[model samples]
Target: MERILMSLQYNGAAYQGFQIQHDLKTVQRELERITQRMHQQFVRIHPASRTDKGVHALEQFIHFDSHLTLPEDKWMHAFNSALPNDIVVTRVNKVDDQFHCRYDTIGKMYRYRVYTNPLRDPLKVNLMTHMPYDLNITDMQKAARLFEGTHDFTSFCSAKTEIDRKVRTIYLSKVIETTYGFDFVIVGDGFLYNMVRIIVNFLTDIAQGFREVDDVHKVIEARDRTKAHKTAPSEGLYLERTFYSEDELKHCVAELNTL
Candidate 1:
């Protein structure tokens, strides 16, 4: 079997999540179905990250092993032709057998978009989170920066997460101004379940003057999930990119910081 790596993007509103569920539609199931049809055999794909339901991905990755020869140059177009309108493979590459889509990942960037106004934009309703009132963008920006180091993100993770290691390093965390509201961008070595959304709500709380700016530190130090507010909605979350090496992660984060 030959190992293949692929980069893809999708509007996840249609799927239950990235992983396959017996009675539910999912991203993994769709890709597997298409790949199986093309190869004339079932091909299992392993994703770099399993995104949540209703979350979109600007740059997602997956790898699979196939017995049939799939021309790297033609696979993207072939898959696109068969895939649903919301999903598309952007690129494909042949890789060593040892290269894994999930295990080789070193870092990831996720963005949460927010739109503010009393009236919701029907078009963006599936993409951005709508806030009825304006948020203090400056305070949100300031609060986001505090998450830029190693911390036990227990307070920021879902109580349902089973991972024992709660400490993770955040390479970059900031809120960028957008015409509507703003986007909360976070780049990190890794994340716990629901961490990004929880952090976003915490930032929103700070921006709305419900909590002190320094409460972020208290939340981290408390190491208690109850300290954090409810998790933000899934619609705003986007898996922007995945990194495999330190050099790539550093360069991309540096480039992102300048934006």
Candidate 2:
């Protein structure tokens, strides 16, 4: 048997989440169903993260062991043929048995998009969250700078998470005005449940004059969820990338350092 790793790009609107739940549609369940059909046997697939409902991913990683000796390209063609149109396996490769899809991951990049236009676009309702008020991008960017480096993100996370540590490194959190809307890119070592949403809400609040920009420090120091910003809508969030090798990631960091 060979352990194969597959990177998936999925539109999470129709699925419940990544994990399997009774009677609920999930990316993993669909992929597993296809894999089982391809092999004519039951197969278990493991994913790096169980993203919440309505949250999309540009690059999500999953690994599974297959006794069938199929080429990397065939995995995508065969698996996607049986799967739904929204989910696609973009890449597949055979990896070491010791390599875990989740644990071995060093960090992930997520983008939360918000439409700050005066009028909402009908097509973007399912994709981007629309906020009519003009946002102060400068203030928001300044507030986002506070999230950089190592910090205890307990206040920003959702309630009742089981993670032992709340400290996470935020490599970059920038607010950029894109052609369509405002984009918030947060690249971090790891994230807590609803952390990105909460952060975005806080920064957006600061931009909207609902909260003071300096209040971010107060919330961080308090370590209370209520002290932080409210959790934004989940539909705007997308996991953009997940880094695997520490060496590869280090090279990325070094490249970024020179920039």
Using TM-score as the measure, the top candidate is 1
Candidate 2, 1-259: lDDT as tens digits: 8999989898888888889998788888898888788889989999998898889999999999989899888887887787788988888899999999999899988889998779989899768989889889989988987888888988999886888799999887778778876888887889999899999999988998999989888889898877874789888999988998776655655554443
**Global lDDT of model 1:** 0.91
* Candidate 1 lDDT by residue in tens digits, 136-255: 889998899999999999999998899899999999999999888899999999999999999999999888999888999998999998889499999999999899889989998898
Minimum summed lDDT over a 10-residue window in model 1 is located at 68-77
Model 1, position 183, has a per-residue lDDT of 92
RMSD of each: 1.2, 2.0
Q: TM per model?
A: 0.96, 0.94
Candidate 1 at 129: error in angstroms?
0.7
Candidate that scores best on lDDT: 1
Off by over 4 Å in 1: none
Off by over 4 Å in 2: 246-259
